[model samples]
Target: MDWGSTPHSSTMYIWHLEGLKKMDLRLRAFLAPLLFCLGFIPLWGIDIQALVQEQVKSAGLADQLVSVTNQMLEGAIDTGKNYQQVKQLDKLYQETKNLKAILNPNKGASKPTGLGAVFKKAIEPPVDLDKALNLTNALQKEVKNANQDGLDYSKILSVLNQLENSLQTALDLKSQWLDTRKAN
Candidate 1:
């Protein structure tokens, strides 16, 4: 099949047809998976812009929690009246409840399991939710145990300091999360 010696003959035509067939098969093999992967992009891709916006909102909420905690500490320190102290404690409790709501919107819902849990954990920021909740609980307990005759301002101050510190830690976590998101 000396196709090179007979470039204008039927043998040359046959050789050219074989080369075209081989190239066509290689092209199809390379393109098929590429097309399949492209088709799945819409299914798996996350909206980075929306995620960044959510991070911003979370950071702002963390800041607000810190501010409300500071106000609670100031209210406890400046007022010696029992009724006023009770009122301030109630306000602080309400603010903590609000912060919890903002941080975990599905608080009462059953937690995800298996692969769903893994994915949820992967997306969540590295913050100690349990520590924050425990701090809030301690604050509530301290306020409830206060004496009506004369509130123990020192104990209340100590609990308030712990709550403030927990809130500050949350704020720091949010800030770090935002910074990481921006960098990526």
Candidate 2:
């Protein structure tokens, strides 16, 4: 019980006795897993945060919406295929534009036309306007609950797929409508 200096413990300290003893393999085996779990505890929070944030970062939920919206609007201004869909959706066009603006506040909402953006546009498989609109609305919902937990991204993604298909359908129908009118 004497920690420092005492007549009864003058030869050696009590703490040193543990170092002199042989540790059991059973204890070492059990402690390894426990120590690893303890060591990993701090990382769980970080990984969860990173996952949630990743789902909304560039190429994440938010960025995916941006890419899709750009395609919709550009298609509207260009070929007039799904121009009406872009004009009339579950949300307003201005709102979609505003939400896309928040992709990178530091960049002042300028459109992403860089090489990476171009490559992504080229490589990204077809995907939605209403679903794109839903994501835009979710992003602007509260700016706090703008993640997977607060948003039904699966449904949004599903709707995105539906939207893509619908656009393709519209183009097919229009092309067919025009074919019937070809004067030969």
Candidate 3:
């Protein structure tokens, strides 16, 4: 039968049936994870190295941010050791990593938080700390782009809001680090 010349409803029914028959169990298994990932798309992707470079603005200085972040992270780890809160530091580190994933979804590890919880803290929403730094870097770019493009301020404000919580968390970590140093 010439399915193309059939009535619209009949055509759709035939196609649907054919499509279902063609779909194998293996295909369904593959599509299950694919659809699950597609459902969790983030708003924007960022480049971590570019962002660090932009924010710090120096030749070959992006590593400094990594060093600083690592130092601060280590300090947090030490604090955890002192307070028997190593769990907290581990949690913070994982969260920071998750934040980085959010900020730089492109370069960020594609491993979904699900079934990938083999880390310091295995029971929290995927938060990327690297992304926090990237967010700041991304905003710097956005501001420059906005100035060049004359985009509305509302978009900038929205980006700022998205990072507000992460920024606060970063600030809190800095403060704690500072206070710990002072105490030492």
Which candidate number has the best lDDT? 1
Ranking, TM-score, top scorer first: 1, 2, 3
Where in model 3 is the C-alpha error above 4 Å?
1-131, 147-153, 161-165, 177-184
Q: Candidate 2, residues 95-182: lDDT per residue as tens digits? A: 5455444433333324467796786557543333344445544544423332332223344354345434433443444455457557
Better of 1 and 2 by lDDT: 1
Clashing pairs in 2: none
RMSD of 2: 20.2
lDDT of 3 by residue, 1-184 (tens): 7756867868698889888877876698989999888775431122333334333332122233334334544765654444333343344345444444454444433456555645523643533444555655554454444332212334334444445544545445545545644743
RMSD of 3: 20.0
Q: Poorest 10 consecutive residues of model 1 by lDDT?
A: 43-52
Give per-residue lDDT, candidate 1, residue 37.
96
Task: Return whichever of 1 and 2 wins on TM-score.
Answer: 1
Taking all chains together, each candidate's TM-score versus the true structure is 0.34, 0.31, 0.25
A best-first ranking of the candidates according to their lDDT comes to 1, 3, 2
Query: TM-score: which is higher, 1 or 3?
Result: 1
Measured over all alpha carbons after superposition, the RMSD of each candidate to the real structure, in angstroms, is 12.3, 20.2, 20.0
Best by TM-score: 1
- State model 2's lDDT: 0.46
